[model samples]
Target: MSYTLGVDIGTFETKGVLVDASGAIIAQATRSHKMLVPQPGWAEHCAETDWWGDFVYVTKALLCDSQVNSEEIAAVACSAIGPCMLPVNAAGKPLMNGVLYGVDTRAAAQITELTERIGADLIMARCGNALTSQSVGPKILWLKQQRPEIYALTAKVLSATPYLTWKLTGDYVIDHYTAANFSPLYDVNKLAWTDDLAADILPLDRLPRLAWSTEIAGHVTAQAAQETGLAVGTPVTVGTIDAAAEAVSVGVKDPGEMMMMYGSTIFMIQLTALPVRDARMWYAPWLYPGQHASMAGLATSGTLTHWFRDQFARELGEGAFGVLAREAADSPKGAKGLLCLPYFSGERTPIHDPQAVGAFFGLNLTHSRGDLFRAVLEGIASGTAHVMEVCRALGTEPVRVLAVGGGTKNAVWMQATSDIGAVPQIVAENTIGASYGDAFLAAVAVGRVLPDEISVWNPVARVVQPVAEAVYARQYPLWKRLYSQSRDVAHELGGGA
Candidate 1:
């Protein structure tokens, strides 16, 4: 039987899957890795070890576990945590660690300089995005200004997915969905790379060739075949960021359909007929040629929960998250008047404030661990609600919200998001996310399935309905004011990073 192979490199882990032509999973595997915080406000990953090494390990594990023949795999695809900036030399060796997405705020100064120099209106008009920490152009400029020695040797700037595609197929290419994150460098109107606004960042020639997410980039090289245990001529498709793939996995195809990814961060992608031009949201051409997408996300979500567990629940051991979820479930809706700002890794979307600080206001000595855990989950839900408010103001409320990811397993967290955001969420049968989507895209690349067939591949299992809660209605406004009133203090402490 024919099969397709898929792999995705995430912030904290890499996962792979082998699926038969009928969309049945043959086997799956995962490898964990760390997000290197070399300093505060900076997030990085070793391209050679963390990105590619985890990929190789996961791919082999899937193949071995499934006992699938190398030649039976029809195509291969990958997705990764992206718009990452990783510079490679002439021979494709990484120059340094890859700078992560919006979570990394090291390029804050460059973002400001470029916004003032190019003007925000022009940038929004051309790129459909404002100068935020998510923009790769500013990070590129930061590298040139702060580490010229490495910049001088840079032959090409690649993101996580492109780096994997290059290793597999020996081609430097990027999907338009992922390329849109390189703001000022990518023109949304033109649907191509442009050096018009930021010529000083890097030469246009250094960027990878652009393609749609499902397009075949190239065939696997013999070297890659040797390492991956795949057929030498296996086709590899140009993949996209993990969020986009995760959206596909859950059947977010229609214009009004939205995918709410509850992963390391709470990322939301809504397919729109036309580009939404708000500076608070992100816009990109969808996986296909003619589709469009508007995106928003919190800078921290499950990551904050992890931090809480590591610091507060060290005694709970490896199953701490499940244990914490139970504790949170025991707490009342509003966590006994406790309020939290989920800006542990700064803020993204709506506010775009890199210096935003996290806090737990209204905390009292009477509160228990259950209350604190519930407050943390509610804080993330509030951040998500803020993004939903932005969408409503723009008149693009989602017709349906498909929720997927590891966080979906936490009943308390899932209920909190639906309750706080006041949006019902549809959960698909398979919550494996991006890797599964990559496999499906690989099938599409080789004409084994159509895009709309995603519904058949993974049908809706259940729905999380929003229940009106008096406490959430009351606490959300105070949560909004808590940030506004504390901005100056947050900025004052920014220098510590």
Candidate 2:
């Protein structure tokens, strides 16, 4: 039987999975990696040491465990986080560690510069996006100003997913789903890179070849085959960002569907008839050709919990999240009048400010660890609620929200999200996040399964409905007010990024 391989490069880990043509997972492996924070705002990754290192280790682990011959692997696909900018030498060698996505905001000054020079409205009109930590254009400008020598010898710029694809096939290609986010470098109306507009920003020809997310970029080479333990000549499909791929893994096939990814950050992707161009929300091409996906995200979700556990409950160990979640779930709906602003990494969607700081409001001496913990959970749910409201304001409410990612393992968080969103969240049976979807893309490429067959492998694990409307109605307004009030203080404290 033919097989497909999906590799997902994430902030905290690299995951690889092997699945049969019918979408049954045969083997799965994970290799944890480190997120480098040389400075508070500068998050980076060693493309060679960590990424390639973890990749080399995990590929063999998965294939060996699956007992599947390398030649049986019909196709390969990769998905990773992005809008990330990485400079590579002319020989396709990395010049520096891979700069991260929104989490790393070292280029905040560059963002301000670009917004002033090009004008936000003009940029929004041309690129369908506003200046934020997530866009690549400003990051590239930062490289030019900060590391001119590296920028001079740069052969191409790449995002996280394309970097992996290039390593596999020796072909530098990026999908439109990713290229569209390159901002001023991409002409929204024309749907192609514009040499005239970005002549001063990026090299026109050095940019990776663009394709739809399903298009096969090239075949795996003997070099990649040796490292990955995969057959040479296996077709490699161009993959999109982790958020987009997760949407595909959970069966976001039609319009009016939303995918909620719960990981290092919280993100929402809703399929829309036309691209939504709000400065608060983002518009990206979906996995299919000519389709658009609307995106919304918060800077902190799971990370806040991780921080709480690491910084506060170090003694609790393995059961920290579960223990805290249980305490929070038992607490009152409002967590006894405490609210958390989940701007720990600054905010993403709806408020693209890196200067925002996370806070706890209405805290009193009477508050216990349970109340604080629950409020933190509720706070992230509230942030997601804001995204749902934005989607509604943009003229689409998802009929059903499909939940995927690490946070899905926590039922309390899932319920909290559904309660705040006021929508039913259907948890997927297989929630391996983007990697699973990447494999599905490979399955499509190899003709092992039709694009429509995704639903067969993706079935719901459970469903949850909103809890209380009155509580959410009051909380949302307060959440909105917090942004304006917190921004000034956040800037003063230099808390963003």
Candidate 3:
């Protein structure tokens, strides 16, 4: 039987998945990789040293664990966070470290310049996206202006997915989804790089050709095969950003379905028959193509939980999130009138303020650390509600919400998210997320399943419905306005702290 492999290079880890022709994942592996913080706001990954290198490590490890021969693999696909600025030389090597996504906001000057050049309303109206920490356009301009020396040698600027695609196939090409993130550079309406903008925006003269995420980007080369332990000449599908791939893995293709990922950040993706554009949210092409994805992402969700556990929960010892969650689960709804904004390191969507910091409002002496901890979970759950309500307001019907990510492991947190969203949350059988979705996409590309038959491989683990309606209805509106009142103070405290 033939198998397919999908690899994902995420912010802090690289993951790989192996799926047989029938669409079931046979094996999965992951490798932790460090994110380089060169400056306070700068985040980078070494393409060869960490990104592509760990991808190869996980790929081989997955195949080996699955007991699958290299020759039996039919196709491969990869996913990575992007709309990044990775300038590679003629030989396809990164000129320097690969700057990460919106999490890195070192390009403030570039963003300011681009914002002035193209009026905010014009950019928002034309591109269907605004320049936030998310867009790659400003980052490219930043490099050209700040590091002219490296920019001069750049043969091509590639997003993370193409960087690995080039590593696998010896060709440089960007997928449509990845290209869309290059706002101000790409024209969404025309589905091509904009001549009007590209005329002045750095040299797109050497930009890579664009393709659909499922297309066969190129064949695996001997060098890639040796490094990843896959067979030479293995066909690899042009992959997409991690969020899209994960949505596909969770069977979020049908128009009304929503895929909620509870990983380092909480991201929601709902498939749509037509474009659903809102400056507050995101819009992208789906992994299967031909349809748009309405996306909502919270800048800090699980990340805040991690920070809390590391700093304060250590006194409680290991598995702090688990123990703290159990205690918080018993706390009264609304955490006994306590609320958290959860913008520890800025925020995205609904309120797109980067300077916004997290805070606990309505806190009283009666509140314990456990009550505060549970309040953080509730804060994140309310954050999901913020995104979900936006999708509803934007005209996308999010019928069945599926939860996939590290956040699902906490039963209390999952239930809390479902409660706030007012939608039942189902967990996927294998929640390794985007990498698994990439594998499933590869399996389909290789004839493992008919395009429509992809759902057979994905099954629900459990469906958690929203709790008592009265509780959610009362708390929901109050949760929304806390951000409005606290955001300014959040900014003030954030600057000083």
- Residues 1-497, candidate 2, lDDT per residue (tens digit)? 48888888888888888998788899999988878889776778888867777777878998889889988888888888776888898888998988988888878998888788888888888888887888888788899999999899999999888888888899999998788878778867777887555568887786898888889999988998888788888889988888888899998888888899998889888888888898998887777876888888888787788888888788988988878878877877778778899888778888788878889998899898888988888899988988888878867878878999998887777777888878888888898888899899988886777877778998887887778757666876887797787677779788432
Screening candidate 3 with a backbone cut-off below 3 angstroms (N, C-alpha, C), the clashing residue pairs are: none
lDDT of each: 0.94, 0.84, 0.81
**Candidate 2 weakest lDDT stretch, 10 residues:** 488-497
Go through the candidates in order and give the C-alpha RMSD of each one to the true structure.
0.8, 1.7, 2.1
Which candidate number has the best TM-score? 1
Q: Pick the winner on TM-score between candidates 1 and 2.
A: 1
Per-residue CA lDDT of model 1 for 370-470, tens digit only, reads: 89999999999999999999999999999999999999998888998999999999999999999999999999999999999999999999999999999
What's the lDDT for residue 49 in model 1? 89
Residue pairs clashing, model 2 = none
Candidate 3 lDDT by residue in tens digits, 1-497: 48888899887788888877777668888888877878666778888867788987888788778888988888999999776789988988789999888777777677778878887877776677878878888888888888999989999989899999999999888888788888788877777777475355566666788888888999999998888888899999988889888888877878888889887788888888888777888777666557887777887777788778887788877677778888887887778888888877677787777777778888889998788888889899988888777777877758888889888888878888888877888887878899988888887777666655546788777888887657667766887788787767766775685
Q: If the candidates were sorted by their lDDT against the true structure, best first, what order would they fall in? A: 1, 2, 3
